[model samples]
Target: MWEKTMPINEVRELRGKTNIFLGVGAIEKIFDIAKEIKEKGIDKVAIVTGKSSYVKCGAWHYIEKALKENHIEFVLYNKVTPNPLSTQVDGATKMARELGAKAVIGIGGGSPIDTAKSVAIMTLYPEYTTADLYEYNFIPTKSLPVIAINTTHGTGTEADRFAVVSVLEDGKEYKPAIAYDFSYPMYSIDDPKLMVSLPKSQTAYTSIDAINHVVEACTTAVTTPYAVMLAKETVRLMAKYLPNALENGEDLEARYYLTYASTIAGICFDNGMLHLTHALEHPLSAIKPDLAHGLGLAMLLPAVVRNIYSARPEVLADVLSPIVPELKGTKEEAEKAANGVREWLEKVGVKETLTDLGFKEEHIEKLVELVFTTPSLDLLLGCSPIPPTKELVEKVYRESL
Candidate 1:
C-alpha cells in the first residue's frame, strides 16, 4: 500500500466547485435560482430526469411550478434510466441543442444528475457524434451551467466534478467511463422534503451505496487526511441515521443527515477515488441495466473488503470502526470489518447475493474477463490497497456469487 501524507500541493488541488443549498425546504428556492439564471442571459433551460420517480413523488410538479413562476423557458428530457446509457446522454444533448437550452437542471438521483452533466458538455460540442463524444480526446473547453436537485439521498452526484456514464462500444458491450471538470454541476440542492416519498428499498440501497463510497475511498492507497475526515464523518452519519431514514422515510432529520453524508462522501471519493468493488460492480450494471447501482454495491462491498484485508489490516480497522462496533476491540481488524459490513447489510435488509441478482455461476468467467478488460482497470488497480490479480478478482466474484 502507498502510505504517505498527501503533499500540501496535492491537497490544495482538490476541486469541489458546486454552490450548495442544503436545508428542509431548499427546493422552494429553485424559482429564485432559475430567475437568477435567466438574469444571467440564459433564456432557455433543459430539465433532465428519470421517466417516473420525480413525477410520482411530486418533486417534478414542484420543479415545474418553480420554473413557471420564474418564467424560465425550458425543455423537458425525461428519458433517463438507471445506469444511464451514453445514448440517453446523446439524446438529451440533441434535445437541448434543438431547444437552444442555455443550462440544464437535473432532478433526481445520480443517474439523471450524471446524465445532465454529460448533456451539458455535449451541448458545447454539438459537432461531435455520439461515438466521437466517447473518445475522451474530444474534451470540451466549457459547458452549459447545471443545477442538481437531490430527490434521493444516494449518489451524491450533486457535489462533485465527476460523472459516470455507460457507453456502448465494439458492437453491443456497454462500458462505464468517467468524465470530469466540464461535467460538474454549477449548483446543488439538498432538500430533505424531496426525499420523503422515496421507497424503502431504494432508501436502504442508496444509504449502503454512500457507506460503500466512504469505506472504499478512505481505505484506498490515494487517500489524504482531508479525504479520511470526510469519509469518517460520512460513516458516523451513516451508522447513526441510515436506519432511521430507512425505517421512517418521513423522518426529516434522518433524511437530512443521510443526504449530507452522501454529498460529503461524493467530495471524498471524487478526490480519493474508488477501488476494485466499483470496477467490478460497473460491468454487472452495464450488463444488467435494470439493476440499481446501490444494490450491486451492497452485494459486493464486503467481499471486496475481505480480499484486501491481509495487506491492510490497520487501515481497514480504522475504516470500519465507526460502523462496526466489534472492530473497535479487535486485533482481527480485516475479518471483523468484512463480517461487520455483511451483518449490517443483512440488518438493513440487503441480503441478496450475486446469484439472487441474476449472476449465474456460468457467467463468472465472462464477468472476470470484462473486469480485466474494463477501461477503468487502471483506476481499479491504483485504488486497491493490495494490487489486484486476475485470480484474486475471480475469487471475489465467486465469493460474491
Candidate 2:
C-alpha cells in the first residue's frame, strides 16, 4: 500500500461555475451529477470518448452505472482519436442530435473532451461545420451542457474554456484552438485513482505539456502576478513528483499533485494566455497529424525559450529554476538556461529532435508560414513577449532541428 503524502484523501468541490470535483474518490460524483441532470429534465446525454482510456482508466464502469441507476439514457461515441479531427466531431454531433442528447459527457484526456466540446456546440448549430466555428466563420453563442471526466493528468480541458480540433481544408490540415465562454464544462472530475494506469510515455509527455503551459503563461505579454505564482508551484510539483509517478504508476500521491499541477496550469493559461511554444507546436501536430501534442511542444520548448528569454529573463529564470536550478535571471544567461532545460527534459526521457521526428531542414519555411497563417496561431504569437517576426520563427524551428 502506498502511504499518503498529501491531504488528498477527501474529495473537495472546488468553487466555480464548472463544479470541479477533485480527489481520490471523486469519480463517484458521477452518480450525483446524473441525478442532478435528470432533475433538470435532461433524460439523455451523449458520451464522447477515445478507444480505450474510458474503460482502461476504470471510469466507464462508474459512469455507466451512474447513468443506468439514475435511469438517464446515453449513447456512447468512442471513436474519438488523438489529434481529433473536425469530421469526428461532426459524426458525434450527428448522432447526438438524432438521439436528442441534451448534454455531452467527455471521458478521457484532452482529445475526447475537446471533441465533446465541439460536439456540444455543433449539435446546436446543425448547419455549421467545425471549420466554420474554428475559423470564426460563425461566432458560437452557446452549447449543450458538458460534463468532463478527465482520465489524464495533462491538458486540463476540464477546467478551461478552450477546445482544439484539426480541420482539414483542401489537402492540408489546420489545427486551431477556439475559446468561448460557453465552452466550459458544466461539471468536471479529476480523480487520481483514474490516472494510475496511464502509460509511461504519456505520463512524461503530459506532465511536460503541463509544464509548458505555465512556462508560456508566466512569460506572456499579459502575464499577471496570479498566473506567475501558479506557474511556479506547477513547475515545482512536476519537477518533484513526475519522476515518482513514472517509477510507480500506482503512486496515488504523485498522481494527486501532478493532477493539481495540470489543473492550475490550465487555469494559468486561461488567464495569462499562451505565447510562442504553443503557437509553434500547433503547426507541427497539424502537419504530421500523428505527432502527440505534448511531444511536439517538448521538442520546440528549448528553442522557443532561447528566443524569448531576453523578453522576461528574471521571470523565466525564476519560473524554470525548479528544473533548471543553475539558471540566473540575466539576459546573458539565455543559452545556458535553455541548455539546462533541454538537459532536464533528457533526464526525464524526452530526448528527441525535430530531425528524429522526420522533419527536414526544407520543412522550416512551411512551419514558419503556418505560424503566421493558421487561425488563432497568429493571436497566440501576439501574446509572446518578443516580437514574433518571420525570421525569429524560422530561427526557432532551425534551432530545434
Best by TM-score: 2
Alpha carbon lDDT of each predicted model: 0.79, 0.91
Q: Estimate each model's TM-score.
A: 0.92, 0.98
lDDT of 1 at 323: 67
lDDT of 2 by residue, 1-401 (tens): 23254479789887665778899999999999999999999999999999988998899999999999989888999999889998899889989999999999999999999999999999999889888888889998999999999988889789999999998777766889999999999999999999999989999999999999999999998999999999999999999999999999999989998998999899889999998998888989999988998899999999988988988899989999989997779999889888999998998889999999999999998898888888988879999898989998999999998
**Residue 215 displacement in candidate 1 (angstroms):** 0.9
lDDT of 1 by residue, 251-299 (tens): 8878877888898998888888888888888778878888888999888
Off by over 4 Å in 1: 1-16, 135-137, 328-332
Q: Global CA lDDT of candidate 2, please?
A: 0.91
Q: TM-score for candidate 2, please give it.
A: 0.98
